[model samples]
Each structure stands twice: as C-alpha cells, then as structure tokens.
Target: MIRRLTALAAAGVLGLSGASATASAAGGPPLFTDGHGLTVVSRPAWVDGNERTFVFTVRTAQVPAYSVMEGQVSGEHTIMVTLPEGYDRVATRYPVQYHLHGHPDRPNTVVNQRMFEETTVGVPLITVAPNGSGRGWYTNWRYPPAALGPQNWENFHLDQVIPFVDANLRTIARRDGRAVSGHSMGGFGAFHYAEHRPDLFAYVGSFSGGLDLLSQEQRAAVIASTQLPGSGTPTVPVESVFGPPIWPLDGGWNRESPAQHVGPLRGMGVAMYTGNGGDLTVDPLQAVVENRAWATNIVTRDHLVAAGIPHTFVDYGDGSGWAEGCTGKHAQPSCLIADMDHFVDLLMGTLTHP
Candidate 1:
C-alpha cells in the first residue's frame, strides 16, 4: 500500500485536495483549520521523497508565548507532518509517530533537513514533529515567571497536538497505534511522555536522550538550555523548570525523571541509543555533551534493567566504527538516523493493524 502511494506521489498526483505537483511546489494557503486551533498552512508536497506531506501551524492556548518559528515570536508554532501513503484515496487508518525535536530546535528542522520523509519511505506511518520550545525541556515548567506566558510544553504535546492529529488525520487514535520518540531533549521527551502518560503511547524511544533528569550535569544542562534564545525574555527561572535544583529530588525533578519512573513503561516497547560523545567533527565541546548523555543513558538503562523492563539498549560507542558512514556521536545525524531506524523496527512489531 505504501509502495502504491509512493508511486502515485512520484507520478505527481493525489496530493491534498488533488493539486498538481507544479502548484504544490509553489506552496500555498491553509488547507483547513481543525477544531484544535491547528491550521494546515502549506500545500502538501512530495518532501523528502514521501507522499502527502505538509506543514501545520498551530496557535495553542497552552503556551501563550511559545517558541518562535519562521523567526516569529508568538503563541503559534509550526509542525511538519508526513502523512502515510494512500492517505487521501485509501480508507485505511495508520499509526502515529510523534517525533519531538530537541531543545533549541523546531519541527521545521525535521521537515527541511535530510528529511524524515526520506527515512519513512514505504513505512506505514503518519509522522508528526511538533516544535517543542528550544528550552522548554518538554515539561510544564514548575514556576514560569509571571511576566512571560506559560511554558506548558507537556500540555502542548499531549493535550493539543495529540487530539488535533487524531481528529484531523486518519489515525488509529489509541495507545496501540501511538508512539513517541525524539533526539537529545526529544529523547527525554519520549521517555517523559511514556512515563507520565503510559496510556497514550505504546512505544517510546530516546536517541542520545538525557534520561536521568536528576543527574547533576543533566540538571545543569536543562538549566543552561533556558539561557538559550527561545526560552523567552527574563529567562524562565531554573526552579520553574525543576524545583530548587538542590539535592536529590529538587523541585519535583524526580517526578519527571525517566530513570525514577520506569514502572509505567514496563510493557511498552522501549529503546534507547547513544554514542560515547566522540564527535570530533563537530565542536570539541559536543564530545562533552554526548558523553554526558551517554552517561545518563547508561543510568537509565541500568534502571530499566533492574526493574526487569524489556527494552533495546544500544551503546554505540563514539560512532567511529558503528557503521561505514558513522563517525562522531551525540547530536550527529548518523546516530539519529540509526536511532530512528531502530525505533521504527521496534514500533513495527507493536503498532496495531499495520
């Protein structure tokens, strides 16, 4: 079925509303605004070699001052969606993969660069990437400064995006058909979502994810992210993000830490991957970053192991010899691609009804 959709999309037909390939190439107005405050803001294009792909800009009430997109700072943000093949003509409903982007990143990165559509070719899934804020940490900040609007990232993804996608797209709309995964902070998000709301996701994955939020360095990293550009003016206080940042369970950080809350993920499909933070090609500092994530990943893996939770853990050290083209680790694309492949493979066995 995916092959048929690919062939049709390659043939330049069946885009949303039956627009011509030539027209879609230009990119046009909104396709439709769903009830969830999300509007299809671009023409469906054959992006990254996939069929029925488009961008949706959502104006969520969750975070009134959400992260910026297209250089605009407002409550609204963009999300890139890659619909499954045969979505328009076929009546079959497909599983949903919510691919959250990392801190300091937007959903457009996934849509434009190297492209997820390229990876998902012939894979029967509807991939959605929501622009989690650059510093929101995918959590409902414990104490967002009263000056800036709320930073309810967790609510944004769970309450707003999920329902919008399920209602607007032909999705299975249940736990058996839903999966979440991410890179870096997104990796944290994958586990965070699975842990807090186990009923919403059947599979969870993190690629170089900071799984142990309670870890000293990991806590510092989250605090540092708030200093980055998208965290908004006045810089959301670290306490708002994770309590006092003091001892073991400071500011409710333990509540969201993946390692501390692995019980809900027992039966769910769990997979984690990280390199030894050996990306010499990138900034030398990236090594430190990846090394920290790798260390935290090990802690989480140990927790999962101790809990007897069945999961796939890949400690592909440094990525130097992981594969032919693999070199460097941490935020490298090669590692992320490998992580995505692994997650997809795991999802294939669990996602319902194909």
Candidate 2:
C-alpha cells in the first residue's frame, strides 16, 4: 500500500498551525491543509508541435517548518505538466506518468513530452516532471546535520506534487493508473518511491540510476566530482544527503538505497536501464561514471532477482547498443528515449484501467 505519512505525523514535522492541523486530520487534500500552495506560473501553452504545457510554482508548507528549526529560508518550486494531443477534446481520463530528472538537471518536460508524443502516438497519458531541487536524492532527511531546505523533496513530491496533479488534471488517480520513472539520481528516486510507496505506482522505471549508494569507492568519486571548484548551481555535498559514507550499516543510507529495499518491489512492474559507459559519443569522465552506475544497477538487479522480483533489465552495454543508434553511455538522449519507449509499452500492456 502507498504508505502515507499520517496527517498528525506530517503536521508535527511541518509544525502546522492549530487550524491546519485540524484540516489535516479531517483528511483534506494533501497540499491544501498546511498553506502548501500551488500557483500556475504560466498559461497552458502549445509546445513541441502538438502538446500542451502548464507550469506551476509550488510553495511547500513543509519546508517552512524545517526552516523554522534550521533558521534557513526556503523558496517555492516549479513543476511542468504536459497533456497529450486532443486532450481538450477528450472526455476520458488518462494514466499519469511521473518522469523525474537527475541531480543538477531541472525538469525536462518538453523533451519528455515530445518523446512520449512521438513514441507512444495513440497512447493517452499525462506526463508530469517535477524538479528535484538539485541533490535531494528524493529522500527524507536525517535532520540536524543535513540542510533542511532541499532535503524535504520526498514530501514535496508525494504530499505536494502528486496531489496537485490529481486535483488539477484528469488522471487515473490510483496505483494501477500511475507510473514513475527517472534518470541518474532520478532513477534512484523512481525505485525508492516504488519500493517505499508501492501503492502509489504500479510500474517504475530507472534510467542510468545510481541504485547502490553504499559503495565506498563510488561514493568517494561522486563526492569528489560534486565538490569540484568550478561546478555550477546546485552543487551538493554528499554528507548533506546521506551523511558520512560509512554507509551500508548507516540507517540513513539503508533507508534510501533501492538495493536495501527490494522486498517491497515484489510483484511491482519494474524496469531498469543502464549504459556500459563505453560510447565514444560521451565524455570520458561521464563514461566512467556511467560504468560505475551500471555496476550499481547490476547489483540492484541481482538483489531483485534474489528476492524473486521479476523485472526488465536493459543493459545497453559497451558492445550491444540500441538499434536506434544509441549506445551504452550515461546521459545519452537517444538511449533514454528508447528506454522510456519500452517503459511506456510495458505500462500499456500491464496496467489495467479501473
């Protein structure tokens, strides 16, 4: 079942006011109760030939609560929602597919929408891509040491984003009608959410995901790269997300790592894709990172198999590439699109309409 944080628990963590607490207890819409607000920042505009896009700025109620404790200020976040062609003419509700982006990458709704539109063709679905606020890792923070500003991404996505999409659009609104997928860090988030909140999604896909966070060597490499002097915005400290790398035994790491939570994914439709980091089209540094991620994905896949969880494993290794001219390298647009196409096909074949 989708394990929702109880209103009481959520209110306590967010420090909701008396009135807000009551509203939460009364089970009001998740975002409406705590002054967590949603504003349409942009009008529904036509984009990428036939799709319609709407952008909403989400002011999180939970972040302010965290800020009060940490004495830091938090800001509103934005998400883009895309509707399929003929959406205005159709009276039918559609399945919702949430596509999550990697760290240092903002939501790419237009590219995702175009990919979906071109690949799926007649498949009607609403595509939602929410910003991960850089390096939140889509996990709830193990507070005090971790910055409270971005660490509450799990709440923002589950309690805020999902509810907002359901309220504003025509959606399937249930587990079978919903799917989640992402790339790199987002791939980890997709599996994390599926394992943690299995009741919220029937299918989950991860593309070039960092599935195993407990590896010491990989952790060290990630930390080194992220802390490079001239890196751009959203440069994150590894300690802020998962604490010290003495992970594996660390509760924080175990809680978020998909490899640690494979039991929950039993019976769920899971799809994972990883490139072998051998493509000449990608940067050599990125190729090395992709190979590391591929190793992590392999370990995660093995765990799932050991747990008897059946899944689709797309290993676009160094030699075996896609027929569509994409190879096994991290962050290849063509490879990601091809993986998404297969994911959508799986969703179409497996999910039953309510």
Output the number of the TM-score-best candidate: 1
Q: List model 2 lDDT by residue over 74-185, tens digit each.
A: 3545566666556555444567889888755567454565555655565666778886655556877654233445456787788778876766565666787789999988
Please name the candidate that would achieve the greatest lDDT relative to the true structure.
1
Segments in model 2 whose C-alpha atoms lie over 4 Å from true places: 1-49, 64-74, 144-150, 221-237, 247-249, 279-282
C-alpha lDDT (0 to 100) for residue 144 of candidate 1: 77
Return the lDDT, model 2, position 195. Answer: 86
Question: In order, what is each prediction's RMSD in angstroms?
Answer: 5.8, 9.2
Q: Distance from true position, residue 112, model 1, in Å?
A: 6.6
lDDT for 225 (candidate 2): 37
Q: Distance (Å) between predicted and true CA of 168, model 2?
A: 0.9
lDDT on C-alpha atoms for all candidate structures: 0.73, 0.66
